[model samples]
Target: MRLAVIADVHGNLIALEAVLADIARFSPDLMVNLGDLVSGPFDPAGSAQAQMALGCPTLAGNHERGLTMNGANGLDALARPLLSPDQLGWIAALPATLTLLDGAVFACHGSPAGGDEEYLLEDMSTGRPRLDTEAAIRARLAGSGGAEMVLCGHSHVARMASIGGVLVLNPGSVGMPGYRAALPVPHVVEAGTPHARYALLERGPGGWSAQFHAVPYDVETAARQAERHGRPAIAHSVRTGWMPPA
Candidate 1:
């Protein structure tokens, strides 16, 4: 099986289109989206519509839950005008998790238990996220049985971890590449370059092998779009893939 996985497309259609164009060359058997789809300074409605047109399997991210559970938070404020009630409802109705290939693959926005909030493969005890220890990752998987592959997102960082014989993968951010986060603690996640990222998984006789890819897009144009949308911080991040110093 050849699967293409994308995640955290926080509403930048340019980057998303670029990444999707690249993925087409692979001619994947299946394409999966790990969510956080339309909650950014970019064209949220357009992004949501594009994803809807693709009809790829998806899981709801925390932003989706926030948009549905309450009319609060910065994301909801920015997203409301862009997405209609029906569109938002459609996104909210997405399941928090999904199992595919007859249990060969399990996917979630965060950990299996944490819904869309926790960082399954990152240790955040020190107020910043670092790759968690093997033991720590294993503990997060306590409720998740031995699935051959597990996919997750929400960290916006591309990573892969092998725990208990399962290949855990995060395809990272397809649109927004960097941002400063200030919940639970203050920290930043950066891809160190303005490139759209995703991952591919292939199953063969040996086992499942994973490959990460970064596709070039119009970073300057994206940054300008963010600025025009009144998101200068995000504009800076888009241009450099690193948050500007305070």
Candidate 2:
């Protein structure tokens, strides 16, 4: 089976469209979104609508919860007032995690127990991103069993880890590729290039093999859009996939 995975769109519809176009080339068996769909300096409403139109299984990221719960450490602020009450309610209703393919795959925004706030494969306590130890990842998956593959987002970093007979994957960001995070410790996550990203997974007889793809898009337009919204930081990241030099 061929599966296309997209995550952490963060409201840049331009990038999302580009990635989707590329994903179509392979004619995937299924396409799934791991969430953080809207909530960025770009068009949040449109981004949310685009993801919803796919009719695919989409998980709710922390921004969705924050938009509904008035928490999320203010991450949802810019996009919150832009959405209507109904839209906000819809986001609130989305599940944070799902066990799919009759337990052959587990999908989530973060760790199975992290609820969109934790990094499933990354340790952030050091003010930077690093792969979590196998033991640490196992601890995060204490109760998530029966899945040959696990999918998660929210780190905006494309990565994969095979441990304890499971392949854990993060497809990276389809919209915004980098951001300076504020939780656990203040640090940056950057792809080092202003391109959209996604992952393709194929279930082979042995297991799941993965491929990370970076799709080109109009970086300048996206950067200017963020600038118009008064977000220089996002503008910088949109252009170069790195935070503005302090």
Top TM-score prediction, candidate number: 1
| TM-scores of the candidates in the order shown | 0.96, 0.95
Which ranges in model 1 have alpha carbons more than 4 Å from their true place? none
lDDT of the candidates, in the order given = 0.86, 0.86
**In model 1, how large is the Cα lDDT of residue 232?**
90
lDDT tens readout by residue for model 2, 13-98? 99999998999999999988888888898988887778878988887988887787655444488888877776777788888887
Kindly give the stretch of ten consecutive residues in candidate 1 with the minimal lDDT sum.
68-77
For model 2, what is the error of residue 89's alpha carbon versus the real structure, in angstroms, after optimal superposition? 3.1
Evaluated at residue 8, the lDDT of candidate 2 is 91
lDDT of 1 at 65: 84
